[model samples]
Target chain A: MSLDAVPVAETRRKGDVEPLVRLAGPDMAAVDALIVERMQSQVPVIPMLADHLVAAGGKRLRPLLTIAAARAAGASGPIEAPVRLAAAVEFIHTATLLHDDVVDSSDLRRGKVAAHLIWGAPSSVLVGDYLFARAFELMVETGRMRALGILATASSVISEGEVLQLTRAHDLNLDQATYLRIISAKTAELFAAAAEAGAVGVDADDATVAALRAYGLNLGLAFQLADDALDYGGQSEVLGKNAGDDFREGKVTLPLLLAAARTRGREDAFWDRTINKGERTEDDFRRARELIVGSGSVAATLDLAWDYADLARDALSALPASDWRAALERLADFAVSRVA
Target chain B: MSLDAVPVAETRRKGDVEPLVRLAGPDMAAVDALIVERMQSQVPVIPMLADHLVAAGGKRLRPLLTIAAARAAGASGPIEAPVRLAAAVEFIHTATLLHDDVVDSSDLRRGKVAAHLIWGAPSSVLVGDYLFARAFELMVETGRMRALGILATASSVISEGEVLQLTRAHDLNLDQATYLRIISAKTAELFAAAAEAGAVGVDADDATVAALRAYGLNLGLAFQLADDALDYGGQSEVLGKNAGDDFREGKVTLPLLLAAARTRGREDAFWDRTINKGERTEDDFRRARELIVGSGSVAATLDLAWDYADLARDALSALPASDWRAALERLADFAVSRVA
Candidate 1:
């Protein structure tokens, strides 16, 4: 299918997402099919709950990075292995969201009720495991040891990061170093593996694999930073979840962390009350947003995102010029531009 | 090492467990080490929570089956592949236990507090995922896609089984056929995979793999049947879980399903009130036990277990003669004898 065949209304306005779909358009459709095929089971709840979460509208960005990275790595044909791995990548992400909702006790996901709330935490948790197992099966079908190792390692890292985030949830003293470590393991690790697996799927050279991993890692960090900023400032439509979710949950993202850092004297008490102690009113979220913007942490967070996005773009220097490569660069810009 | 090298105290009265330990003694030690090594992580809760469950003394029957089956299939050497696979098998089992407890809302496991109760359900859910990922990584490191495929598929089947069990939980009308299907997927699938992976680890012939799978499938059926019986009749000290755990959970195991089938009139109402409606008085358990025994379901369940054990023993006819072979046969007897 050509870009010309795509309906004009369906075109993504986001700079990063557009190039991703445009370049990997045909392959992603196949990946989508594979994902749907593999997630089905004789057990009804597995499909019912899994499909509910899948339909909740995650952008499939991680898998897109996978397909695009593989194409850029010289497998330009309609190959099946990377497409399978891409499906696996999406499965892993969806599994995490399912488990995280149970962990955080969150009711909302992607503008819908969380799977745990709808089907019960047990179903969400088990189906998440099912998807994860399915992910490995797909990776194994890739018949690539490197891809398996990268994903398996990423799964462990993501879990570790989640546990770290759980432990450090409301600590007013959460340092930037700890926060970075948490995000690197929880978010960036899978992103890095997703892209690296794409290159490795085609047996790309070590240098290319390393470059893709770096690009994905930095892109993941940028993506997460932008997510943090959006949590405080963006609308529910843009956020895909309710705004001020992090505040109510007392999650200390960069904007909140930075804003707390900059606050002094009387302002420290407010941070302590709202975030540390979880004492909040309907008006408290407005006040928290005001302090977050007033202290310039939102801008600072976007700046940090921009810096990471730049790093992500620079890492792509090793890849040869291609539509896929350019799209990845644009993805870095779009990640930060969401906050803009 | 000879059998005399084993200490007198180490001899197991159970038909199967002794020879497994005696035959695979040295390699199992290595598998234990791998389990410990792979479970370690920088995030404290992962290792902390995982180790707590590992130390709680659930018999490592699943991993031992993998190692012993490998030995039976002619890999007698202290090869790292089977050992790693065995460790991976244990990790998968333990991870399921962690998640299953959360799903079942059970408070105790293996005479110790379940991980979900201790660390919270979310931690168990997430850490279970970490261990699962670690399991796949170990299988991949074996450089055997077949092994990875077997384990991964088993994981999905097991999750499917868990969901089925959840859906059918309070339905006293659940039949022998549906119950068999659930146990086969949830319990036997993993056991079968564990045995088959052992054979596949040595690149065993198709005939050999099929024989091993058959052996494992029958053994798992026998084992679960005995477990159901034990839940009704055995002591907590013997079962390693509380007696009447199924009764309290209202889980419709084989014994209960059979008893419910046999019961009529007022007895039917009793089961309906207890199992279906979740209304139980303290003395109702005592009366329920009497009804189950009087109904002869325990005897019938044990007979069914014996039949499966016979099938398991028969499946071993394909394997070459060895001590491991004899041990597997004895293990089959021990499975049925547990209920007897």
Candidate 2:
């Protein structure tokens, strides 16, 4: 667990996202411009609240996937359509984050104070609605109904996932399959749709589009699993949120579920009180993390994440070997490598 | 102000929406069917929470406007596109209601306990989002991008208006123009878009489409103005919500604005205490209502509504003579007449 115990070569083997970021820089800049231009409104609170989150900026990974998919799928001419679709995808993601913060009552997002906390929940909710509508407006401007449908369905599926999670997230008995389904719906679906819409926007062939969508889906699963693992094994400065947020909120993510199942009757009272009864303290979180880490649950989660990352990289075999494809392969490696 | 002072003929002259309801019945039935079918999801909570609102069923006036506009614009053939758009419009409206109740923390909607109360605020917010995504999915099915654009823009405008109202709702100094802007964005934009999308769906001529949009805008303005008046003047049973909700929330609608201006110095202290200070009692609401009514503010609000209604009726002159057109004119009249 100490830095001295870790092998230097293994840390060096952990891949980076720098290649994808460097390659997609120009396209992403255009997407960012579109995002900034569209989030503005005559109402001051809207732009102010929206910019609080949008300006702070995350990895911008979803839209980058969108643009990468378009180019990787052999988009040759002007990439304006894919660029706009990429912006729309970001808008949709931002909107969901706004609503999610309000729904979860989380205190931080993208390493900044949550928009809902600063502007109040009502403004956050309304501005979320505004961004969502603007996303569709951007899609409509592309005159691509198929891409619109993809994002629309993804949006619906995401909410359904959110509702399912809200209803079942506190259950101590939740199985891993249901947890995966929830993450697939809430997190992975948008990734898949973002890639699929980008391909569709570029008039990519059906096979190419399907392959990119598969890549996105698996990459999303890997990324989310790694994220879940990171919550327990990583630092707050790195995660942009406090460790044990899931534990404190009684949210039964994969790490907790795995640790619960592995510890079975041994930690019954501990798990029951913290998760089911929703009673916890600083010491309990420390103890819970100890158990989760001591059981090798985080390692098991990262291993599964690596499997998905491999599958994501394998999906790129369908495409012609190019810098975009190679970068995407590295990106998938980075998905799980970040947890290393 | 008593019943004895009201003219019998004027009571009879106040029009009703029955004609439009009856005429749009079959198309609305299809729209209703679509709404029920689309709101269903594997996530049981989604349908249950959505049904809690959708099943209570408001007047369906917005969707009816969509159908009526299509038919009145001389769509002689099958009106499938408009029917779908009508359902989409209702979904948007229902989604907003879900978010609005959560934002306002209201107790009732459509004579039922608010969805957020029955489920939870988190569930309500997510369900609203699900319905919104489903709305765009429905619009995508129609394959009319322009229609989609109209609804998308309206959705954005509605959210802007909502945020505006949320920030300014407690301001006693809110001007008439700003108040009108808020209502137009929050309440009337959907109405205008519903009718406009309907006409566009039916491939109506540019003039007819413009006229229907105008009709919808005016009707929505009139309907919102009347509803604001009804908060002070009408019964809770008839209004499907507590009559004084706006007053209790300190939402400075047109009726309150007019009353504040009329009372000026006399009720400045009362307005300051109730709205600005956010302190209220039963006696304060009663006294405020008396002041609003005694100053003829409700009547003035209704008078403005009547003007909009007349403008709505005038918009119908662009269409040919038909029962649909006549019913629409009556519907406009009913918007204000309900306050009588």
Candidate 3:
């Protein structure tokens, strides 16, 4: 279905994460405490630099997924294991963000100056490593080998995805399938692993674990797609990052690729000059955004994100009905509702 | 004892690694194969960048220590676990080297062009991450949680050490204790983990594992001390990197710290101009090297290395008499012999 088929007011009504946030609050508090405790090191700069990013907290959505998955999987006794795993999931996400800032030379993250700008690229790189290693240490303490393997493989896949993106950065001709593959690897794999690890940590049955993983994968895709759409249509103040960052960096996202395809022959020179040759100006980004919105690419991207969100909600059918399950379903809607 | 107390020829005779290399050749071949196989990825650049560093092979000393420690601890049946752990050790080391080159902005590594130069710094950072994740993947395959813990902790310590070094880069006031702490974390901790993980993987006793770890720790210190000395005294061709690289970068290594202290009043302006101010020139480097050597700082550094070498040999006394033990004893001496 296209975005035109749905009412804007109806879509906006579906976008709320309050249910999941309230349900996961106590567990997330534990996870947050663990994150703070583990990130501490005798090397003064490590915690200082790490705290700069961790403190300027984003949604903490990945770890929230871990905690929710564990609760949904019927974990009853002490959830110390899931709590630790959730902290680890956040550490891995933060670590990747730190490295990505350095790799992309980003100027802002979570509405604050990027860590690399304040601490220098060298410190950012090393501190990212420190957090990555700490993530594994936390997993080891959990004594869950399968969960460790899931995150380890996910980490490798994420890096592979990142390198793929780096190599294909400014290519205007990047196909839809390749773009999907890049995002699936770089973003969804971690989501899948985070949920799968939590289920496995609690010794959930195979069917339950697989279902949670599927849910996380689809949810992650929806979130990323919505994020890409927001970059074109949403306000920078609300988004916590500049709106034209993707266009400015010549990053090839689904919206840009779709817009470029829609405007093919007419805007070929414009696309080549701004994206391929990398000679962009303020006027160029403004015009590019107008072209993208006018071409209906943002609506198309949101439509695709809605499809993934529906799939994510469907994947929760394996679990018995509970408040946690309903909360997760709403969270999926929230992933796409950001642009509303 | 001072360098004058020991005859030069006697110390030279103690510095060969041939025995260890010859004995570990077969196992190292297996590790080399695993390294080559695991580094390959569908993303062409991952393997290409990884191969650039892996192919321009260093001594592979860390993994060899892993193999020898397992063998010395009497791992008899199939030795597959040790072999995999050895490969994991190598991957971890190579990953660190890739990041370290980017961090230091070095032009040469393992006697060849640094990987970051061929690819960009972004690629180098991500590829290093890929190898690191792959290292954990390898360890996960062996089902050795304790070994994973050891390597995981080592990885954390190494980054902390690197951050410490980066923050203190050009400080002429760096003391010997902090210098040792930096090298211990960045260099020696991996050596200790490599050996300790091997022993632990083979189900060796606590005493035996501790001994091997001690041996690795001392050998690592000796090797780093000798490397710091070589930056001032050794030939560039033999060293596989430019001599005076530490001086050029204003790195506060042990030899520089020693020399700076020895000529404190006499060469205050020279040290201040070159190191603290970072206004180094070719002539400045030459003069600094001359002062370091003429002041007998290199000899004093080598003397400390020899002391660590002796401690490393002494730690091996816990293991039974075996070819592996003898080879490891010689490897400690080889750590110091690089500058010979």
Candidate 4:
């Protein structure tokens, strides 16, 4: 499922076309350009700050979903709506990362000093607020009620998730249900919103809208699960962050949750030492990773992720076959594959 | 104006009579109840923490404006729209105050412990996020695009104004224009939004919207200016906090802006003693107050406040002459007279 194996299918094949790639190309371009233009307006400070983060570069997967969903729904001509919505999504994501660094009190982001460490906490907080404001303003300009509703709901959900995450942090007894809810609200909501916005823009039928939403939500959940797994086992160079960053921060990711469950009675001491203990060193993190891996939690979690990715692809089965739809399927494969 | 003089206003005035007061009674009741209801849902830790600060109530003036404006337009089927909007405004205000206390590193709010001081910094930050989320959810229930637009824009403006205010802090060179823009965006934008939401809900005409916007904007400006004057001159009992909190925080309020202009030769010494010098005591604040008063800056600022109040009343004059409109007129008078 990971991108390590999927050949970059060229020019859309007979049956297996890259629908998301085809549909999202212009949309991503629009979003990319808009992000640069809007972010550039913050003269002397905002632009530079924004650029430093943008240059660190995420996968741009969320914008891809937005554009692909729009195109899949028969949207054409200008399509400024999806682009703007995509940019707003990215802004919200970036703002949260900025504040998250402060909340986590981390020093590094994408192999560089986090904004808080570089510019200070006050600057980070204000800059995050600025980005949030900028995003809302962009959303308002779209003048779409459905779009506004989706984005606003996503935003509130994101905040709720963050608070939930914070509340559950360092509490090893936190259940899987709570963790899943956190990820759904914190992460999947945006992906779902991004995809749904496209259909909303073109005034797509309810079924199509629902289908795209399902695709995005499943894809997002799978994507986050893969991310959680990779943070435990993947390389820092590929991921743009240190391995076990979550473990170091005491976050209860999927692997840790599974590992905790596995260690319930047999390895209770190990759970207390690695999971409950806050004073984690390089060796402690390493051993914890080994414990999680040995418990088969990582592989089991990957299976769950693969299932979700499959479901994501299946959600698009009802749509008419198109080059853009093919790319969405590929993107789902890539979401899981990339993490694997 | 001080609520001490007007007391209860005897009996409730009918349609358009005593717009602010009539609006105040019901809106306050509704807002207070909603705030309490929302505050109750903060869960394990944040609820009591938020309540501690929420109970130290300031006048629910922003919510009053929202409900009053809607009622003044004669839409009384259900005050739900304005009530929700009012709650949204209050939530935003509370979130900003929480962040502001942290930013200022202050220990007091309305003669009680600040949220950060009482609940710790992390709790304050997370709780602020909680309130922000709650506000958005409330907006979603209202289902008005204009309301969404106004609330989102106002919240952004507040943040921008906060950033601007931060940069201008301790810098005596801040001009009247920047001062007005900061306070207007920070304070007036929400008030304007609250009023605008009222018109938006009832689908009032553009002229009515414009008039209400103008009234809100002018009133907000006058209120802030008078607030600044009170920080330097009003007694603690009436103001609800110690005088010169602004001075202690090294904020360049309107009175300070005026006083700085009048200082001429003593400018450097004055700023140096008051702003550049950190960790001010009561004696330092007292001397700064004396300097500001001796310069006639407070009086000039008060005159400016009256000017804005007059403009507010002028805007209200365009509305139909109802009792609510009359109450709005008194609210204009109240804006300036509250601190005097």
**Candidate 2 stretches greater than 4 Å from native:** A1-13, B1-12
TM-score of 3: 0.97
Docking class of 1: medium
List the TM values for chain B, per candidate: 0.94, 0.97, 0.96, 0.90
Candidate 2 vs candidate 4, lDDT winner: 2
Q: What tens digits encode model 4's per-residue C-alpha lDDT throughout A272-302?
A: 7666777677887888887787777777677
Inter-residue clash pairs, candidate 3: none
List TM-scores for all candidates, in order: 0.95, 0.98, 0.97, 0.88
RMSD of each: 6.1, 1.9, 2.5, 5.3
Here the TM-score of candidate 2's chain B is 0.97
In terms of DockQ, which candidate is strongest? 2
- Where is the poorest 10-residue window by lDDT in model 2 chain B? B1-10
Q: Which candidate model has the greater TM-score, 1 or 2? A: 2
Against the unseen true structure, what C-alpha lDDT does each candidate score? 0.85, 0.90, 0.90, 0.76
Residue-wise C-alpha lDDT for candidate 1, range B1-340, written one tens digit per residue: 1112212222323465787778777888899889999999888899999899886747788888898878898885567788899999999999998999999898878888778787888788888988998998898789988999999999988988899999986688898899999889888888999999988998889998999999999999999988887777777877877888889988888888888888876588889899889998768877877777667777778778888888998999999998889999999989866545
Residue A328, candidate 3: alpha-carbon lDDT: 94
DockQ for candidate 3, C-alpha atoms: 0.90
Candidates 2 and 4 compared by DockQ, better number: 2
Q: Give the interface RMSD of each candidate.
A: 0.9, 0.4, 0.5, 2.4
